[model samples]
Target: MMMLRKFKIVLPLFFVASLFISSQTNANTDPNPKDKVLLTILKYVLTQGHYHPQTIDDTFSENVYNSFLERLDPSKRYFLQSDIDEFSNYKMQIDDQINNEDLSFFFLVYERLTQRIEESKPYYKQILENQFDFNNDDIFDVDYEKSSYAKNTSEITNIWHKQLKFTTLSRLNDKIIAEEDKKKEDETYQTKSFNELEKEAREAVIINMDESFERIEELTYSDWFSIFINSISEEFDPHTTYFDPVVKKRFDISMAGKLEGIGARLQKKNDYTKVSELISGGPAWKQGELEVGDYITKVAQGDGEPIDIVGMRLDDAIEYIKGKKGTEVRLTLKKMDGTTKVISIIRDVVELEETFVKSSVVKKDGRTFGVINLPKFYIDFDEKNFRSSSTDMAQEIERLKNENVEGLVIDLRNNGGGSLKTAIEISGLFIEKGPIVQVKYRDKNPDVKKDTDPKIQWDKPLVVLVNELSASASEIFAAAMQDYGRAVIIGGRQTYGKGTVQSVLDLNRYHNLKEDIGALKMTIQKFYRINGGSTQLEGVHSDIMLPDRYTYMNIGERDLENPLKFDKVPKATYKLWDNYENFNQAIDNSKKRIATNNYFKLIDQNAKWLKNSQDDTLIYLNYEAYKKDLEVHENESLKYKSLRDYTSNLTYTSPLYEQPLLEKDEDLAEKREAWHKNLKKDMYVEEALNVLSELKIKPQYHLVKN
Candidate 1:
């Protein structure tokens, strides 16, 4: 799967909708009365306040119809062709239903899906009762998007058999290989027969399926209703989403950057919850067991019996993993290499320190350069005095200047944006003062967000590092730097083109009802660079482009459905930085170096190989053929193994002020050590420093270290 770790909490600005509901409530009793009110408010706000509201017509209806069904049964396994045929009747009529606040289509599909899910349980149980023939030459195409739904119950049963057999065969192969390896390790080791191993794999699949169904059975009506609502909301834009009360609470916690848990983000993949990211300095990271891609199979509290979580809902699985601070939560993980490990962690308040700005000083040749890695433009919306990225960045710059670092590299790679105000503030620190970005609401003239502060904090040579994952506020900062000729933008062909600004509107505020109607995160404004170009579809083009893993992949805002189109506005008045005499020369020199660099060449080749591998999703169900395919890919992957071992000739160290803090806190020390080590291996940072070194400062602007 293509893992795009997108941080979608962009610019948390709130705008109260000016909606007024009449005192006349619905006299007719309905189970979900709030649904109608929510839908009515949602339509009004989206059409009136959205930056580019989509037309809700027959086309919109068809899109939602297709999207909702696909989401309900993505594998094309649950619902049959008959079910699809029935659902298609209201495909075009959905627009009218939505306009009238009618829930007939939603109710029909929801009820049918619930019925189909219950019916499909026996199919898997019956299929797994017998051994799968691994010797047969069968191929399972994993491209479910292209696969057709089964015509009848018999056809669906056959499809289930193939899918279960594919799942079992893979496990059987793993068991066979493990037995052989054990036999080789000890000459007198006993090995089980193929039939015996096949039975064990089948049993394992049964357990997993049962747990999956159990989790599905636990889904409440609210869960399904949220999905139906989102299916409509997402058709407007990818980022715009409806957050039910439960999900909205989670979003708030995530934005606050403090949670009482083990500090690992989990995503449901197939029947397992995979570890997406581990918060640095969190309990799990401190314990040093959980890793990204590891499947969390079971979770236990304190010394209790482990509860299998392989098929559990992500929200439920998290409940088992998270606990009050000082409580123990043990997790059973199925590692990527097929080994199982039980890890215990004492839950704590995991303050996401890594989400803030962190800086490191590195020495190249004889001069020092500073690298500031800003994960996001974070700001506490609730507290005015709370730490903000802009203030932290300003302080870090002053500290770097105190250390007499000659150049600065602001690393915004993988920073999927946060606060817009902070981005503009941070941009002002580099330049004297000018309009940073233009924000345009629907049918309104562009409002210029400027940095009125004329004091330039860092007049020295500056380089900004961005990649395909740098989005929203990150784009705003990078664009401002590029437009004003302030910083030399490097890495990736373009940044993530997410120019739209979103504002969370509390839906309950529009009504006098005591019930919580949750909030709507809708796109309210589209931002543009000072040079008039919108970074909506085409992100900021890097001045010094470099090849990365996602070089050939279809990523960013344009890849998303119904993204706003790129357009231009009147350019804001801003003066270009004329202090750097060899700006063009620095870029040209880096391009020449990157052209012949073996490491970059290997990276480009690896990216192409990865793209091809991702495209070839077909799996050989026969054991021998499956093993052979894996072996071929494994050998091919060995060619790019050296990429991990490549390192640069640079020494990175923590800043002087942070040195004392690191010595006191071992976790902080360890985090910085790991960061410095990665910096040493980073070729991009090395190249960025090279460009910074080549940038010749104007004679009058040059300063001597005190």
Candidate 2:
């Protein structure tokens, strides 16, 4: 673990003046004025404001060079070893170039990249023009990271040939299976021959390939520059990134939790626009049609014909989806379960109310407990009247307290976190008054954020639910609760380990340039737990570990590329909340029950199987072998089907106090009903309830202030 320390160095105006005086030759051939200005502002911020600034030397240059190359051609599809060899001349010179605010290296690489892309477009098209032999036993390595650049043009051509064959075979296989299924459904259904299906698959590949090349051709120099700068910035840390103007707007919308259109976040996965997340109370979430893993293959507005989005850039596809609040967008989506459907969604303001704190009263084993689902630590900085998570959470706790609930569960699962101020205030609700988290800046002493308030709201037996997606502020709250013995952390092995704080500095603000140069989201600090441990890559461990599908997955800060290392500092002086002295006994009982419970055991087995399957990257190119392998995996997966239907006998309803409000708002009633129904099927929630039941401490006990 590396603890954060601050460095305060004020460079005089003459220092920047001298840098320009010594680098006049480098500017004569600069690619663009915006790039030059962007370079100056970026360099100044990274060196002066970044948390862990690496020295601008040969080592740093090498990292930037390699990272840029990887970003440009991640699959090793465009660039060959020959091109890399030719580009090595500037590998060790990028650092010096940065010092001079030069961009000669970028221009050189961009020219070559564009040329190569134009030259290579014919290779794939030519390969897909012929039929592929489905009988050939071949394997394709789907993992791009393990692949190396082609040694020569011949190898590049061969790679394209194999890739086209795999694509064509997959399409042809699906077509054949669909025809077979149709014949089974209708006795008079006409079937096409294998040759005809293969021909159609090849034609589809060519059409898709042509559109892909066309989209690739639409990339502007600024887009490439954005990637270049981000590559340079991310070398400092994975969280430190350069967002172009367009992306900055998107970031703002996401942070604000208000957007038009279908209210779903989309990402490009291998030329297909995939739904990453659905805003909780947004149109998409309310529609209950689109899912996280669904692929949006086509989009249409109003009653227009659907336009294919496959082989289109994610940004371009998003433009078609986003519209006025009253508009309508129809999406043709392919579900992960191999089902296709066209879903029509009416665009709206996407209220974002569902992300707020919502509580449900659960009656389990003849005892009532309150469960509060907090999606994120959201806050509105600009508007004082806007509802924040901390304030909303406090009110919810008060409501739950009035209901005489025995124990409370704060659900932080899938919470990516936001607003550190809100997290600090929420921590105050649990503890009387002490340090909750420590923030360390470069070369400066760690600043401990303390909750000075003496009032402890609902200091009862508590449980905090977390998973792999629980991050940053979520980690802080959970770590503080665990450190103080205030609450038992449950779910997953640990939370998402993003402990660093990022400050987005607008590049245009630093310079007098008229052009919008976007912003730099740089890591400026690392936060540590009150107990001296930094959550950086390790995150906060669950007090009571529970296995899920993500248990064996590498989806944390540690798994991310170039994350800040974890380290410790001196622990803050804070007193523990000793309300639950028999906490260890409760943990033991819960573990024992989980081991014997068929639901949990099945989940662990399913997680193991998922991990094993993910590790196998090679896929059979032959249709028969590929189909057999998929069939076997799907059949093996059927045993865990009962997990989805497994429901706990726990009955959930709004408290009597909240019942009137539910009746007043039917929408709220539906939301609560849907949430409670999901909770009944949630194995993790069931275990948390069990843990609460086993706690020796009762809600009536008053915890002594520190």
Candidate 3:
């Protein structure tokens, strides 16, 4: 569950532990062999070809080092002066080449960023200064009050920099940057230059700034708070984190995607809670006349005239949409391509069945196998953590068995994992009693989660589907299954590879100041496979590689600031399942053949185009060129068929809701309330089903001849 801490847990930087855990670990105490061994292995794995960054000067300040140490020790549980001393051996010497002038350049850039952030303050002031016009129908059209967050970060950093009583910011950045680069080099990795990277980063920031700002308004007080806390962690290190109260609620919702509402997804598009996507089987989707991309213009309650919601905050809009499931509501919508309509539907308890164990039959190449598409390794957030995706999956396996299905394909495409407990529980359904995954914290003892339950759920021939978005818990389940030789992994190169565990911290508690601000989401520990490999940056590998745009090393936890390093520890004491080796070899052979196929080449070309399109700097041009290029590329990317995946099914090419109204509903008054319930939670269970059902071809159909 997304838990937001009500209070921050602040403390003096360190507590002397009685462990001298690793050569690089700081706790001053007798080390446990398991912990020490793990530390040594991780230190070698993460630090071997990399360098750590710091910004210390002649003053030999320890604060920068302290901050770095504090980040690794999210709980501040294991690090001590002794650990700091251990790291000192590898600390870089800040030569003149990398001194103030160089550092100041970056600081200057940061300053400009801050100035822009400050520019937003006045905008925020305008919002707060303007009184809500209750009499006017435009209350929902109120714009966001801007705030000075980026500027604040700059201010905080500058203030801290001046207080540098000890370190230089550049020195600090260089150290980490050097370390990362060295690691990359050691691995023979490919990356862009700093100049190019900066350009790319700038464009991305510019594009996302408005989007992220808008998101703040749409987010629940808790969701917004959780993200705020998470971003705070980014300031310290990609891993150190904190949380406020509301976020924890969101984490709970993620496991099940359950919420109190009409079961449709809403977005604050230009000025309203836009119906971006309608949840299948939900009240709205069942209405038959409803279309995707419908922009909701107004909403009304019992006996109340419909209130215009053009510019309302997404969170506020949500409050309007959620009520007792049996309640009735009406919506006046504008379609995207230009159409309008009034639809009335009743709300009811909407269950996300697709997030549960969904099964289908894949009949291809004269072979029939039962397919269970697990979009995510979800767990129930409700009291008692009563239900989980794995538990439900086991039940589905039983149902598939009833259908006399042969083999199984577990689809995890775009499935970012939800619950670790569920990942292990679900993996248990495949393998015999053994360690499911091996977890190692910075200074704590290694924690080995197990699937020791002797009873296996379904050990039939199986395959796991993974893609760029399959991360965290998804990697765990897939990896464990592959390790046990229970299933073959299929899809992208690996996964998103976020094998770290994060816990929310209330920074306000620790500081006892500004408790009203958001909290932090800190990375406390890193997870590993029973085989001893960390899932940090390199997610699980697939037995069968598919042509996908995300196959490149473009995203995930590794790309963030203050990220925990990837490494490995001792392998857990677990038995290796047989026959899997042979399965992998066969898969390898299949992949080799597909890699050289002509069709695959076209797919790869499209993948590259998609990737390039995401890079903003690539499209820059001076005035004339900008306009010309924009025209030429207007819909070049759209011509690609894959985008259709995101386009909701509709009869018109234009966005459904923004269109002009053809005719007003004659029964509007009668069904108005009933229709409102149909317009809320918008997820894609039905679409996912369509994907599965359509995929039910025989093995012969899987191969496409040239």
Query: Candidate 2: where are CA atoms >4 Å away?
Result: 1-28, 261-349, 381-385, 698-706
- TM-score (all chains, Cα) for each model: 0.87, 0.89, 0.51
lDDT of 3 by residue, 1-706 (tens): 1323222232333211211222224334422222232222222222221122222342222333333333322222123334345455423421221231122222232333234435443333233222222122211101211211123334434222221211111122223455577867788655555444434333332333344345433544234223322322344355453434464455456325455456676754434466644554467654655544466765667445455454445655676666667777777665432233567767765555445655544343444456565655666566585777877888878766765665666777657676788888888887668999887655556789998788767655666777776778888888888777666677777787787766654333322222243334454567889888988888888766777655443555555555656788888887765533245455655556566755456557766765554332221222234334445554564454443344332111111121232135444323323422221111122222222223222333224310
Writing each residue's lDDT as its tens digit, candidate 1 over 121-240 gives: 899889998878778899987677778999989988988888788767756776798799999999899999999999988887788677778778888898988888888888888778
Q: Rate the local accuracy (lDDT) of all candidates.
A: 0.81, 0.81, 0.50
Worst 10 residues of 1 by lDDT: 1-10
Better of 1 and 2 by TM-score: 2
Pull out the clashing pairs in model 1. Answer: none
Q: What is candidate 2's lDDT per residue for 632-659, written digit by digit as tens?
A: 7777778889987888888999877779
Ranking by lDDT: 1, 2, 3
RMSD of 1: 5.5
Highest TM-score: give the candidate number.
2
